[model samples]
Target: MGPSLAAPIEFSATDVNGKVHQLSEERGKWVFINIWATWCPPCRKELPELAAFARAHRNDPIRIWGLSVDTEQSPDEIALFAQSFDLSYPIFKVDPTSLRIFGNIPGIPTTFLINPSGEIVARHVGGVTGADLMRMIQRNQSNK
Candidate 1:
């Protein structure tokens, strides 16, 4: 199942670099908001693929943001984790318990795909590959 669209979800969060990123600000592009954790095995495995996907689409109208739901870790710790993976995309530390904007995050490694219009078009509960993401975008684009 996918997100229940109840008017485009909006949120503002500060990334590890102290940069404020808002979902509304990315309205004109495809946005991937991935909720992950530092200790999750699948999250660790998918970081590189998400990073590569972000790099490959750097010039495109696509954006990927990683939200680390590691309540036990500090910002510096999360930053270090991202750095170790060579992840260049924006990473934010968020408390999963307080993240009501996206509804219940049943598990880690959950990814939400938001369309250019700001509506969530898809949601995946496990690790995903770059190819899988691209295919999703392509399919959505074709449907439009």
Candidate 2:
């Protein structure tokens, strides 16, 4: 709920393809790093909208990534889940130790909005509506 616009955090995680993707490479774009688990209700509910947003703004400099924190799910299962949602953006299988470095994730469906300069702009810890996401993008544009 606090304003974390100036706080900086570098996210280091690999994509589904197993290639390492660093936040340093995602500069000059507003990256929506959505943290979710397979079993969370709100995570499941809002994921489709997230996918649609990514697809709709394919040409935009915005990148949405779904980071699954589930330790029990395999890569194939995660791929199937991504396919089921028709997800357009990248979905990464994150290590629990990696996640723990970010924060104590006691809940599911947490989101972090990173600006073009790789700074954490905002943090949403629950279900986010499509309108809410749209407004975030609009705000990011306005800042530019």
Candidate 3:
């Protein structure tokens, strides 16, 4: 995972709490955009680590955003999933078509690391660990 990635297409969606969250607001911080679905096993496996990453880097200027791609799942379902992992960050129902904005996401648990300037820096298309995540953040911070 390195630099020279494309800029993410700007988008926003309602968080689990029914509040509108915008991608543009994530500027000036290291943002982790995780594209996932409830039915994906790998996605489920990665949630806890994502949550841990959120907590571990709380003081840092970093944000982890989960984009659930479930077509028919309600906010309650998403809430339950987030609760199961005891997620400290927010989850949003991003439109399936929105994945096109980042290029074709061929798998679940896809993750994109967007720098403070809103440019994507790296991507992981499978399970990831909290340690690995921490390393990515550190790398970004060092680059900045």
lDDT winner: 1
Error of 2 at 32 (Å): 0.5
Candidate 2 Cα deviation (angstroms), residue 10: 2.0
Itemize residue pairs with steric clashes in candidate 3.
none
**Which regions of candidate 1 deviate over 4 angstroms?**
1-3, 142-144
Q: Provide the global lDDT of candidate 3 against the true structure.
A: 0.82
Write down the RMSD of candidate 1 (Cα, Å): 1.9
TM-score of each: 0.92, 0.85, 0.87
Estimate, for each residue in 55-135, the C-alpha lDDT of model 3 and write its tens digit: 998898889989999889998888888888898888987778866766657688888888887777777889888887777
- Give lDDT tens digits, candidate 1, residues 1-144: 434664687888999889999999998899999999999999999999999999999999999999998989999999998999999999999877546777767898999888888877777899999998987788677432
Best by TM-score: 1
lDDT of 1 at 90: 95
RMSD of each: 1.9, 2.7, 2.9
Error of 3 at 86 (Å): 0.5
What's the lDDT for residue 19 in model 1? Answer: 93
Q: Per-residue alpha-carbon lDDT of model 2 for 43-77, expressed as tens digits?
A: 99998889888888799888888899888998779
Ranking of candidates on TM-score, top first? 1, 3, 2
